[model samples]
Target: MELRHLRYFTVVAETGGFGRAARMLHVAQSAISEQIRDLERELGVSLFNRENRRVRLTHEGEQFLEDARTVLDAANRAVTNMQRSQRGELGKLTVGFFVGGMGPFFSSIIREFRRVYPGIQVSLVEMAPGMQYQALQAGSIDVSFTRALPAIHASQLRSEPLRNEPFYAVLLRTHPLARKKTISIRELSEETFVLNDRRYSPAVFDKVITLCTEAGFSPKIGATGSVSSGVIALVEAGEGVAILPQGSRILSSSDIVWIPLSDKDAVIDMVLAWSPKLEQPALRSFLELVRRRRKQVGI
Candidate 1:
């Protein structure tokens, strides 16, 4: 009938006698008998054949005994799990990232979290900002690191600003503009630029176009792709120059040079965003880790 009833029934079935079950359950023999009778009555079947000397289970009782034990065991485990979750010890955490630059920090955070909370499991998904937002909205991910999220996606999520990485110009090592430590907007006006399509990373693209226009010339566009990595590869091949966040590290190559853009406001925010619907304990722990490491990244 209730959790207590199943627990009392299972104990009696295991011990095979009310007197012994009562002792094992820390209840009086009469109280144990009454609870087992109530469980049988609620189920509409006799669970045990009564005898002055020994007790045996009825056919229905044998099947019900197994079910009862299973229920009791599961209930106990649920309680234990919830208690651990409350202590930030046991749970699942799902996180999404927009770029690979977080690889080292994320790995360190995961190792530390495991040492501190061995019972929790974490899942990490890396995707572009738009896909990460959709995953958060659909309840597939709990938290994320993203850049240039739009107002529509921002409405469905809570974002915390972590750091700002200013724009930098990427060029082949032999390119003329690679000579400057920082180039003014006016200086790069005549250069051909390659980048992700406007629809892919709109905020950055719009700013780049506006800055170029404000500098008094339209950009001589060379190529556009749908991904950041693709844009970087094209820049590497000397197809065109590119402006991206300084956080976008250029790998070791003989032909690539990264130089900062001189505009004071030319920067992209790296932020932590999450759906408003989630308040999972494991997610909270992960956010704490992100916050700690974001500072190390100079947020």
Candidate 2:
């Protein structure tokens, strides 16, 4: 039978009379009586014993009342949970990041988001810039924090620049230029330059090349690593010098020294990228939080 049938049966059972149930439900007594009769016919069981002035529930009616209440309670809870999900109050959000992605600023934003939406499950996946873009496009990750890539020209994806910081020259401690507080990109023309593979971050690789070219010399490619950390390790092993984002100083090594680049163009942009096609309440809430955080910091 329908939910209304169960409700009408329960109300009549509780009130002990058709007239009282109808009045409580704001319906005609005759309407309640007809619905109850319909319920009994559907169930093939008499639910109530009607007397001249009183009504009493039969054995089957008493048993059915408990099940009806349970079913209604579960239905109500399901509706509430659906509403919560739609409002971005609860769900899972998969976030992608590259090496050194947990810089102070990015980590702070994540902390604040967790504080605000504790019900949303946030998980992190470490990937290169190229892989992050691919994952985002493939719907494997919800959003990503990565360096702005020139190769990511997908129309379905949107990127928002969050931070722009200069690059630093990473060199072996024994190198004479390592002692300098800052150096121009032109001074490194004679040295072998270690760089991460273009597949890791084409934008960063291209930026380094452009900066060196603008300084009247193309970078002498001495070595290449798959990721930023690997490039740093290669530098530590004296493979060659490399340029890295300023924030990468946090991944320092005793054998390596980070010297700031004098060229203003030797910089990298950190951005948040996501696919517009997969818009959802949780993603929207997170993007809004990012905007609010950026405003608070005057970024």
Candidate 3:
């Protein structure tokens, strides 16, 4: 009926005597005998044959022992797994990240985490900064690599700056400015700026506007792309130039040139964001690992 009942039943059956099981379990012989009697009454079967000094299992006891051992083994494993999960050694960790925003440290951090906590399962979801914040608040994601958390979420979440990324000008190879080693934000004032759609990624949209405004001109909006690839495609079509983070260089091509911005404020901050109440053990372990390697990763 209970785990202890199964445990005592198996121990007594293995030792072949009430006295021996009692000694092995550090209980009185009378107590072990009483427990065995209770077990037999509950199951309505005599589990042991009463021999003078030693006991042998009845036909029913031999069959029950197999199931009893299985149940005990499963119960033991359950307890061990629960303890490991609580200690941040086992469980699943879901991470949300920007499509191209995770900098150099992201891959290294993940590699180290997987190495150190092999028992923990890791999942990655690519999301925009706004979407990442929403997922964090809804508890769908444990942690996120994001940029520009909106003021509305400032009170609900906690974040740490993981990387400060500089902006670059993405232009068609034939564009005159593409020939320049570095371009200032002011130089892009007259050029149509293709930007990520404000609805999907307001932070990037707003930051681009701010940079242009700070450079003494309001950028002419040429088009908007709902996705990063869409933005790149539009730029490749020569619709307009784009101001993107340095990480966007990975999408570079012979037709598209990525020139660093010379403006002093041409930078954006990439942060590791999460809910203040992180209850998952695996999430805590991941955050700790990131902290330990922050200096080494140059973040």
Candidate 4:
């Protein structure tokens, strides 16, 4: 029999009479009696013993009642979980981001999201821009925080401006240029540049070259590191100076200084990108939270 049959049977059993079950269910007494009768017919068993004004469950009915409650409870839980998933409250969300690329606001936004939507399990993957693009395409990740994506993937994904991180002149605190409030791109031409390997961060590496070229000089390459912190470490040891994003300052040290670039185009856009085909409810929730805090992070 259908769920309504079990529901009516349980309600009649609970209330000890068809009349009260009908009142509690806001239905006609005849309708409740018909459904309960249908249930018993389907089972080929007498479920209740009718007396003068009330009914008592049979041995079979008592056992069926427990099973009915279990089934109903499971069905209710399944419906509740489905609704919560649709509301972006229950599910898994995988996000791919460049290491140290999201800057300060990224952490804050993630913290708030975790607090507000504790039911959504969040997994973070650290990927370069290229890998982020591929992960989005392959459905391995739901969202990515990255720099400008390749033109080929541009049309296939939707992106929003997250932050505009300006390039910085990284130097030893003892260096004369470190004392300047802002150092123009031209002033650092004579300095050797320490950089993260291009494979790890090709966008930043290319941007550094373009900025120096526009300043009428080619930066002399002194060393290369596999990561941002490695590059910063080289600069700290007086190996060479580095031109990095403003967010790189998060790897702060008293021996190093970060000065903003003066050139107009000395900036890069950090964006949040996701494949339209992979936009899940949980991802939508995250995007909403970012939009709310977008202005605070200079989006």
Winning model by lDDT? 4
Q: Write the per-residue lDDT of candidate 2 for residues 1-299, one digit (tens) a residue.
A: 78788788889988999889989999999998999999989889888887557899889988988888898788788898799889998888999987675577678878988899998999989888878888888889999998885654557689899988789999999998979999998999999999979988787888899899899998889899888888999999888899988766767889999999988787788999998998789998999999998898898
User: For candidate 1, what is the lDDT?
Assistant: 0.79
Q: Give the whole-model CA lDDT for all candidates, comma-separated.
A: 0.79, 0.87, 0.87, 0.87
Give the lDDT of residue 231 in candidate 2: 90
Instruction: Give the lowest summed-lDDT range of ten residues in model 1.
Output: 98-107
How high a TM-score does candidate 1 get? 0.78
Best TM-score among the predictions, by candidate number: 3
- Locate the minimum summed-lDDT window of 10 residues in model 2: 147-156
lDDT of 1 by residue, 17-70 (tens): 999998988899999899888887888999999964678898999999888888
lDDT of 4 by residue, 1-299 (tens): 78898889989999999999999999999999899888888899989999657799999999999999998899899999999999999999998887668767878888999999999999999877767887898999999888876677898888987878888888999998878989888988888999878776777888889888988998899998777889999999999999888777778789998999889999988999999998889999999999988866555
- Runs off by more than 4 Å, candidate 1: 10-29, 38-71, 86-88, 100-103, 250-252, 292-298
Instruction: After superposing candidate 2 on the true structure, give the runs of residues whose Cα lies further than 4 Å from its correct spot.
Output: 52-54, 151-154
Using TM-score as the yardstick, the better of models 1 and 3 is 3
Instruction: Give one clash count per candidate, in the order shown.
Output: 1, 0, 0, 0
Name the candidate, 2 or 3, with the larger TM-score value.
3
Q: Which of the two candidates, 2 or 4, achieves a greater lDDT against the reference?
A: 4
Span of 10 residues, lowest total lDDT, candidate 3: 246-255
Error of 1 at 44 (Å): 10
